[model samples]
Target: MDATIAALEELTPVSSSFAPIDDSAYIRFARTSPGTRTPVLIFNAIGVSSELFLPLSLSLVAAGHSVVLWEYGRVGDDGDTFFSRVQSYKALLGHLRAGLYDLGLEDCHAVTLCNGASVLARLQAELPFAVSRAALISPYFNLLHVPHQSPYETALVPLLMKAATDEGGAARFVHSVLNRGGHAVASKEALSKAHMASPRSIAGYSRMLRDYRRHDETDVLRRVKGELHAFYCLDDEAVSTDYLEAIRSAKPSIGLSTYAGGGHYGIVDNPSLLADVTAYLGGDR
Candidate 1:
């Protein structure tokens, strides 16, 4: 790790060249980094929507690790129904693997946030890969195995699917319901603007909730072959401590990193989390 960072410092002798992308919807790769250390491959939380994980990806790249943001936009037919299941990730895993081979990043450290970790964990269990380490940030999986009381997230799966399919009517209904109930904070305008912005992700979330049993995150956690690390904010309103306890019960081998604050999306909003994850992925741990 030191050697890789040394190589990075040698190559990049100036300030960090991280560019800020609008809405955090794009990915930027490391132009130069030693491949001796494992690469960090991020699985964007909501299928092709890279917004949630973009900050961490940028941090890892700035820290001189080759961070590969996955490509699921080209998946499925015109990328509409992509990432609907673990098989979807399986399909692109080969493509991602091929890209890694081309770039000499075959050995990897898998990093994902929220629901995407479900698919990623299942991928490792069903079809093992070369991931030596994994980081799941505020993961919400095993919906059936665990208990949840979020009306908008759980009870409204069908309605959410409708919102994804026919956004005109259902989106407003959902946004109104969730917003009125203090569930989500996206502006009504933002919700409306998301009409066709990420149909694939919207649809996939519906499936994730509807078919939660298929993910079997508990089994995946128990069966994971690498050093699995799960991060969470103790006070996260969205994902509570019960979920953390469930993960511990499922697999005692997995490591847990809990913080007093940072909430659900702390990896993006918290500077300490950004630095900690960057250091961990850079092989400092």
Candidate 2:
């Protein structure tokens, strides 16, 4: 366990340069191998910061792929930024594109999870650089069609914020949401990492949730020129089989894989999933 932690910590250190794209946005991303042309760009799940992606980033690096981890500014804090979904997406996407250029990365492969996939699917036609391949893990492309949550969930926002502020509440909440809740220490650690995101950004995520729309899947898929690899987890609560079927119908050419038991967060640490991603990035797909 100590060795694993050490390895993840060593993936990208603070000594690496973090470039700022604008006053409201910055990206702390670095390429593991400068000469390696095919970079793996990670589109982290919304509401969760880039820090939580360290383990997966480290694993990808170990498998001989350059990785890019990124996040954007918080909303409602900047008058220049509005509380719109497109505004949020533009911010994150802009920062990442600028950061990649600054880091001398192009012709990359992208790996996205959950809402990140949704954003990527919508912006597939607008990417600044060429993409060789793209992988979607438990992609929740149809956010509007997902099973509805309790209406009371919004009312409990204050309580949820309170829970996130305390260690025990945060742990319980993380454990409950994650597929691998049995790992208590990991759950707590994840909670700690999530706190790295600013409150304004978190609030913006809530706003995004309230205002999300279902994009035209067929049209979006038609715009994507790169090879697509999609993974669906058997135990993911956030994404359903219907979602997968919808995507399959829209983009039949996409390479699809399913895991028996990796909830949304499980794939982040699953060795087989990491290996598959590495293979795809390495053009073995």
Candidate 3:
């Protein structure tokens, strides 16, 4: 247990604070020390807590940029309403915007991964304070376009529930999601974090997988005004090449960074990928 705590401490020493989105819910957020440039906001994939992005956060902080890591709102089963969900999304963004305001940042760069990328781009079109620039890692513009995909093809609720309660289940799920292409391995810290996730969070991820097929960001992408950068992992199983190709075809101006070796999560931890992200955020590219 000492070793595990030490490992997690090395990964993410900074702790998180609660930022309220409403009376009933709040987002878990953590910020690193300010860097030479504007702060960066990082959004994780479904079922992936802010802890998963600690390596990236550490890198950004080392590069002299403050980084913010946030988890999405929990979706409860009792009062599930489409309108309520939409409002939650809006409130979440407002909460994020508030985080920036509290930090005294007029504008900052956004780094979003997987489904979070889609969510950010969609909300950016409607938000009052837009990100100055954005970096996307293994993004999905449309969940339906992923190869061999279907609506709720994977039973995430039960699996995540099991994972939350059992260390072995958490290890299995973490390996399947994070360690892809036989390149990445699940860290003990990662597994422990997965096992400690709240049931509400697990339900939220299940709901996202079940309903994400209905929300397409094509129109939102067209209207997005910020300078955009996308990183694609060739071996990532969860995302599709077709969706990226379609995005590139539709938006010719968006910059793309492809990694032949790094898997989805691995790419975020790669030094080269981090350099590219920092460059883009710094307007050096």
Candidate 4:
């Protein structure tokens, strides 16, 4: 683990406070501020908790902006008994926005990573009044293929689930995934630290992967009103860049940036990528 990330992990606090959206669901978010009037809401990847984005969220807070990171249904240590099984993505966004409003943040910008991008895009489409701008890192609107139940993933996930219940398991899973791409953008060391900080995050992430295959948003992208910025790594093995190009072409007005390499989780691995996203959200691009 990098010393800087380790130190930041130590300083960051875990958030448990939540607001009920319905009898079955609620939202949890983390807040940090540098006293900026304009707040930024970060929608994290499906399985990972909002804590995965803490390093970057803290940077945004330090830069004089308020940062809010939200955890989706079934993704955290919070109770999941009430989580809706209906797959209503729009309702999920509404729940999250209500939580943000409760925090006294009205107008806001947004940043989303991986599968979280589609949710953010859908939110902009459904509730244009709340969000002003968005930045998507390693965005994925669809999976390249429905992951078949390989004996490897099927057998491995259970073991991963067991180990991931503690700090050490989180560290191993993060290392294993990041290592697959040679740590070009997200170094194995950085991922290891993040895992130790939030061990059970993979369970949520795995659930996300399962749920995403059942949801599609081609219609929503064609209707978004907010300015959108998308970043993709050319070598990403997880999701195809063709989807990014399709989105860019669908909305020619939307700005797009592509990097040479960062595999699937590159956004977490590279701070420079976040810098680009921050600039776009700030209207510097």
Candidate 5:
């Protein structure tokens, strides 16, 4: 356990980076190894933050793949996200797309859990950079139950939407609700006091939830250029397992795996699921 904690602390001494992706977005690159081996890019889950990817990131980087972990200004604040710089989600996406193109990271394998899956799927396909392989873990693609949301979402999101008018206050409230009841502690208080006190640039993260659910699954899949792998944790509360059928129907050829256990962020604690995901992203599969 000591060794594991040491590894996590060592890989990303800082949970997030201050270097702005744009006026509002930021990335938490745990480790960067530029090499001939294909690189890996992990997308950020909404409230979970990119910090949760540390265990997975540590494994991937140790396997010799350059790994970049990123998160945008979403409706939640785990102390890692900068709500102050948030523009609309569309603007942040544009910033990331531009940055990826500038760095020539066009062929990287991409992995995302929850709402991050939506954004990764939305990246413009016309760009020279094409995602080689994508692994969607407990994906929260909202297109499922198209006529309505799953039970969990129905109970919680409306309240959040109503509260988004107060940016900073809403961020904390949303964060508290999405903290998985503290089931996942990797997103511990890692933000600096100064960073926390930084002035916010946005009026509020009012459009975030709407932005995630607006993408078309089929269209997003059409844009991806490689094999797609999805991990469905049957117990995930933020996103239900029912979405699997919707995703499967959208892309019948896409690979699928299911686990009856594990929370929304449970992949970190469930070593089997962790290894399975690592093999897929690390190309051992």
Candidate 6:
């Protein structure tokens, strides 16, 4: 992980270089190989900050792909800010287009997970020319049945946010969320390393889940014209595999893959899942 830390630290200076076009948050992207021209755009899940995608992004970069990871301010904090939400999506789409243009990319592949899948689908429907293929990882289209901010969860968010902002709060929060719960997949050591790498980003993450709920993504998914890959975890506590299957059934052309054991955050803990994803993205069966 020392190499990852070095790469991230070297990237710190370039963090603020990608300015936002409007109210949307600007993203910090790291390319492993500057000379490689493979362009890939990533839209991250709402509940987590873009930093969470870094591990996978770096892996893709190592495979000779230039990756762009999008950040959407604080997720649930913008619940009441409708204009900001719209502008954020618009700005993100703009950023994707501009990045492709600057890279001289004719077509690009995009990947999104959870709530991001819906966002990317909507963008693709609006501008079909920009995206060539899409991959949705453990997508959450509806929140009604999915695990969401119950009264207890809602109350815990602010407290967690407060603690996450305090010194060593990130470590405390990750331990409480991932280790104490029977659902935790990552070891304390891994969580500790992640916390040290991106501390303050957790506050933004907690706020993203403040007013979180689920909604339908069928409409957006139907409009996406590119080759689609939908990957889901059967053990996911937040979303049901039935829903994912329904999406696959509804879209005959869309390809589906299921991982039986990984929980919602399996994508983080399972290297094989990333390998499968990389193969799919590379047009391998």
TM-score of 1: 0.66
Clashing pairs in 6: 76-208, 142-215, 143-214, 143-215
Better of 1 and 5 by lDDT: 5
TM-score of each: 0.66, 0.69, 0.69, 0.66, 0.75, 0.63
Best by TM-score: 5
**Model 2 regions lying over 4 Å from their true place:** 1-25, 35-37, 73-87, 143-188, 195-201, 214-218
Better of 1 and 4 by TM-score: 1
Over all chains combined, what TM-score does candidate 2 have? Answer: 0.69
Instruction: Please identify which of the two predictions, 2 or 4, would achieve the higher lDDT against the true structure.
Output: 4
**What's the residue-level lDDT of 234 in candidate 5?**
70
The Cα error of candidate 5 at residue 109, in Å, is 1.0
TM-score of 4: 0.66
Cα lDDT tens digits for candidate 1, 52-171 = 455565567666666555433322232333334332334444444444344444557878777667656656543334788888787767646677644334556568767545535665
* Candidate 4 local lDDT, 91-148, one digit each (tens): 5566765665567656788888866777776666444347778787766665333332
Please identify which of the two predictions, 5 or 6, would achieve the higher TM-score against the true structure: 5
Scored by CA lDDT, what does every candidate get?
0.55, 0.56, 0.58, 0.57, 0.59, 0.54
Instruction: Give the clashing residue pairs of candidate 1, or none.
Output: none
lDDT of 5 by residue, 79-175 (tens): 3344445435676677667655555565778888776777787774745766778888877555633543555578656655654455566545554
**Better-scoring candidate (lDDT), 3 or 5:** 5
- The alpha-carbon lDDT assigned to residue 213 of candidate 2 equals 40
**What's the number of clashes in each of the models?**
0, 0, 3, 4, 3, 4
Clashes of 2: 0
lDDT, candidate 6, 211-270, per-residue tens: 333235566557767788877777765556666666665577877787877666566766
lDDT of 3 by residue, 102-168 (tens): 6544467888877777667766654556687888887766634444332222433346445434535
C-alpha lDDT of candidate 1 relative to the true structure: 0.55
lDDT of 4 at 55: 66
